[model samples]
Structures are given as C-alpha cells and as structure tokens.
Target: MGKAAIRIGTAMAALALAATGAPAVAGPQDAGGRAAPKTVAPLMGPRGVDALGHGRTLVTETGGTFSLVVERKHKPARVVPLGNLPTDFPPAISKGPHGTIYLLTGASGPPPEQRPSVLRGAAAPAPATTLFKWKRGWPAPKVVADISAYQKTDPDPWDQEGFPADSNPFGVLALDDGTVLVSDAAGNDLLRVWPKKGRIRTVARLMPRTVPVPAGLPDVPPPMGPLPPAGTPIVSEAVATSVTVGADGYWYVGELRGFPATPGTSQVWRIRPGSTNATCDPAHPRKGACKRYADGFTSITDLAAGPKGIYVLELSKKSWFAFEMGLPGAEEGGLFLVRDRGAMPRVRELAAGRLKNPGGVDVSDHVYVAGPLFGPGALLRLR
Candidate 1:
C-alpha cells in the first residue's frame, strides 16, 4: 500500500485516441471504449498458438513458467513448460473435461503461511502437482470439497490477518467435475479445492465492508504520493482481480479497485451458491457463507462465462462488460449485452494490436485471452 499506493493500483491507462465506433470522449476511457466492428469468430488456434478451446492453454508467465498452449493449425504450437512458479506467481489456467488442465498458483505470501501452489496438468509435461497451501491469517476459500489434503495443513486454524507476503494468485478455475477455484489478490480469499478426496477449503473472502463512499462519487483521490501508515491494507483495497465460475453455478468475483494508476474505478462481485460470508460480519460471530452480487465496474481485470453471456474484462482501457444472469436477487436483470462494441474489438483497438497486461479470461467454446508479456515472456492470446 505504499509504492505510491501500489502504483495507483497497477497503473496503465493513458492512451485514448479513440476510433472503433467512436462516441465516448468525456474523460478517462480505455478499458474498452472505442473500437467496434468485429466478427472474427472462425475459431482457430495453434498457429503461433493462443487457442484455449477444449484442447489446452495454461499460460502464467511473469517468468514463473506455466506455459502450455498446444493447438497447432499452422504455426505457434509449442510452449510446454509447466513447473517453476513463485517469483511473482499469479497463474490461473483452467480447461477441464477430458483434457483436464488446472494450474492455480497465487502467492504474494503471508496469511496462515502456505501462500501459493495448486498445479495439475493431465497431458504434456505432467509433473506439476501441489494442490493446496495457505497459512498467514486463514479463511480464504470460495469452494472446496477436497483438494488432495490441501497441501497438508494451514486451512485457516483461526486467521489473525497479517499475511501480505506479496499476495497475487489472480484467477484459476477447472470445474465441469474436477472442481478447483482459486483467486487471491493478496489473500483477500476465494479458494476451493476437491481434487478427488484430499479436501481443502476457504470458499470465499473478498473483504467488502468499506462501502460508504457513494455520495456524489468522486473523492478518493488525495494520496497520489505518500500514504500507507494509517492502517495499511491498501493492496488496492483487497485486490481480488478475477475469478469466474458461471454457466449458472454462480461465483464471479473481480475487483481491481483503483489499479494501474486509477484506470477509472473497478468493482465486480457476484457470489451465489448460498451467499453469506465473503469474509466477516454476516452477522459476525465467525461469519463465512458469501454475499454481494453486483456493483458498477470500471477496472475489472478478467472474467468469462460461456453460453454467450457474462464476459467482463477491463484492463484499464481494453474494455468489455456484458451481463445477463438474473433470478436469485433479480433486480430487473436482463441486459443481454451492454458494451458489445462489436463482440470485442481487441478491447479499444489499442492501435489495432490491443491487450497489454490483459491477465486471464475463459469463455466456453471460444474467447480465451491471456496476459503477462512486457517483452519476451509471451502469453498474449485472443480467441
């Protein structure tokens, strides 16, 4: 919370030439504002590879290595290297239903203590299995029936709140039957493992509880410099990043909250399944069930649901915010699509190339999207 408030949450939003559909010029627009006219949906991966269909795709390379994109139709089809992780580890890859591939690793460190480790690959490279582990503070889960033994221990014991070792296990999912969801933007929580029988759980814990800044909606800008002694905990107000699990099962959590230098404003929460504890005060006494469904978003990182519905990915300008899931708390829900902008024009067309620090995204039959590549460390894919 002090590196200039974590670089204004992650900084990277200052290029607005606007072009696509044209017609959004008020102020800060990037997370997908212009750039329309899109219809590239033939579906073809593995030619320089970026395919995330039913086959493979488990990229998470800040340098930690989790690369494995195999789908060769012509060129790019070889990156297999699923091992080394823990330098800036924020991997989240999921593709389960036969080919089975799940690699959820997030460890900015701290909490009960375990930190990050949950790798599993069913095909090529094979050897990468950790399952579960998290110590410093505890109580971080969103779904879990079992996860091999949860690495052995440190499930929560009775959290104390102090682990900020680095915290950054961004998102990971592999449902269909395998069941493994992990998202820990600094241990704000959301881990559920059940890889067979081992069992290990935390289910959900995105903090919440800060709500009160909604008078006119523009006041939080004052610390552009030195701040972080008051109470600390400013990892962009419980970071959270991205976590998807929706064909209807319900479990979409994406909170960037002032990232990459005030991208514009970020927020996205929707946890169904039972709803009660996201981390404290459901009525207190212990709390832990899960609640909070919708909220205005502006900086949401990545989240994709198939069937052609919920797809939210806003990396500070490269935009996307489509929704349509109502019935539980149904507040007149049913918007089919809000910012289609031509289905996805590389999120704002960013000079025609698009996607810079994208992150992670997964939509059933098509639409894949990855991140992490300032230069050589590739993982920049789009479907």
Candidate 2:
C-alpha cells in the first residue's frame, strides 16, 4: 500500500495489534459543569463527528456505523444507531444547512493483509468513496455523488504514484446552497459536489509539502525498507484531510503531511469561497487563491469551524508516522483552537495531552472530540 495506504482508517487495526504493551486508558476527563470534559457516547473506532443542536451529535465509526448521540443534563447519554454504510471506513459526516446531514466514506478495498483473512475479501455492495445525504425521517441516505468515478476521469495532477487514479474522500463541508466540498486525501485535491445536480468538480489542488526528516528516528524492520539519514528533505504529499468554512466565510482546509509524517509539518490553508484551480502550497502560500492560515500542526485529521474559531484535531502529538510505528510519546493526541490574534493566527491547545488518538472534532455549545481513533473509542465533550 505504500503512499496510497497512508490513509487515516487503513492501518489502524494492525498498528493496534502490534503495540501490545501500550497502556490502555481513556485518558483524563475534565472537571466542572462548564469546565469539565466527559464521554457522551461509547463507540468503536469513532472517526467523524458533527454537532446537531439541542444536545444532539452525529458521529461515524470506522466499523461502518453511524449514530446520533443525545445527552441530557441529569441522565446518561444515549446512542441511537441510525444506519450503516456499505464501506467500513465512513470517516466523515457533517450537518449542513436546514437540518440536512451529509456523510462521506473513505477509500474502499480489501482489509489490510495483517488483518484476518475472512475480512480481506469481504464483499462490498457499493462504490468505494461516495457522498451520501440524509435528513430526518429518511429510511436511508441517498447517494449524492460518485467520488471514485470522478477521480477515474480526472486523476490527481501531482500524484506521486505511477497511476494517479486514487480517491479517498476524507473530509466534507456542506454549504448553505446545497453544495458540498470534499477533501480527497489520496487525490490531494479539494472537490465541489452539487447534490442537486449530481455534479462534481475539482475546486483546488493541494501542493506537496517538504518535511525535514527528524533525528533519532527508529530503525525499520521486515516488509518496510530502511529510511535515509536524518536532515533529509522529504517532499511529502499534502494529504488534504479536512475542510471547513470559517467564521469569516473563507474556506479552510487542513493537511496530514504524508510519508515521513514530520511533526509540526502539517498546515491549514485558507481559500476564498468559490475558488477554482487554486493552489494550497506552503512554499508559495500567499501568492495564490489559496493561502496559509495557520501551521505547525502534527497530523491534522479533522477541522471544524465555529464562532470561537477553527478547531483542529491531531491524531497524534508526535506525528501519524510515529503513532503508526507505536513510538513513545505518540499515543496521546491533542485538540487545538486556531483563531486570528491580531496579525497572526493563535493556536491554543484545548485538551493538551488528554486525548488518546483522537480523530474527529466539532464545536457546538462546546468542543467535542472523538477518540482512541483505532478501536473502541468514545465521543468526548470538552469544555
């Protein structure tokens, strides 16, 4: 799978199985009614989350299920299973305008070789990566866009692969006018999909990121090859993972820098609404329709914008590569709020070292993060 397999929900099970001696804890829950954080729902491999008003939240799991989490002040939270997708890695979901809900599925394929053989050739009944739409009282979600078909016709221009036809729709943002924006982690581009017309188009292409190989890296073993010496400049894929509309109305997208997965190398880019063919290159950030918003993040898996600011979710504090390798100091994830502070963007850690492999985040009355990311996770309410 190499670069194509560096997706969020792909190798989680294998990585978990390999790290047998790692500690198993839910991390710390915060302290008061207004200042404490608590788990609102118990889920397995929770990957996507979005807030629905009146103490309701929509969460998706890597196991292909999605549910509505309802919380009451005096009672325990209730998780109501709504429906399940055909693909296992339904990584993203969002509540759009007028109570409409949009769900996105990641790349579909056989299970990783490390997993059980029974799961490898399991039959999939639908397209690999698709956009689905649903609303209250709907029996099931309706297919709104065929993302994989679109990629077949229009491949990634800057893909490092010999065959550029890869599409993993990881992030989704539903607009007020019924248009949705999707970030393809494998395609390395932002796409615009019109639900009403069943049309999809490339909105922008994320440029490659140059990450410096950090020192003291662990040695590789077996099927994985050896790495170069430290200080090598590795040109990594942008791995466009999440998208959101800012409070200021600009479109913000975040990246999970590929390969080597250097810590603090991931970035968030700001693009003008309705931009076409824009570039999100960190090198020439301010020169195009897409510009750098805030950076110095490690393995950003999701981005959610609210009145406060853009909430960024990092899968691991050290980096995704380190976490995949089960390195020390990589198990604890982080949540941050990025907002404009005078002339610069200020990133403040909301739950520093308090989350374990958190993958999804959203802001409603307060910030919410979904965790353990790989297996048996929960939806946490942060204050």
lDDT tens digits, residues 1-383, model 1? 21111232223111111112222111233235644212222111101112366646555554344556665665556666644443333345555566555554343212322423543421121112233322222322112222223323433322233333333445666667666676555545566666666454666665433322221122234554333333333334435656776666878777655322233335445565544334522224123445444444444556776664566655434221110111121111111122223423122222122443344455545565543212222333332
Per-residue error for 327 in candidate 1, Å, reads 27
* Range of the 10 consecutive residues with the lowest summed lDDT in candidate 1: 323-332
Predicted structure with the largest lDDT when compared to the true one: 2
**Model 2, 313-335: lDDT tens per residue?**
88887888887776887887878
TM-scores for candidates 1 onward, in order: 0.28, 0.90
User: Which segments of candidate 2 are over 4 A away from where they belong?
Assistant: 1-7, 17-36, 108-124
lDDT on C-alpha atoms for all candidate structures? 0.41, 0.78
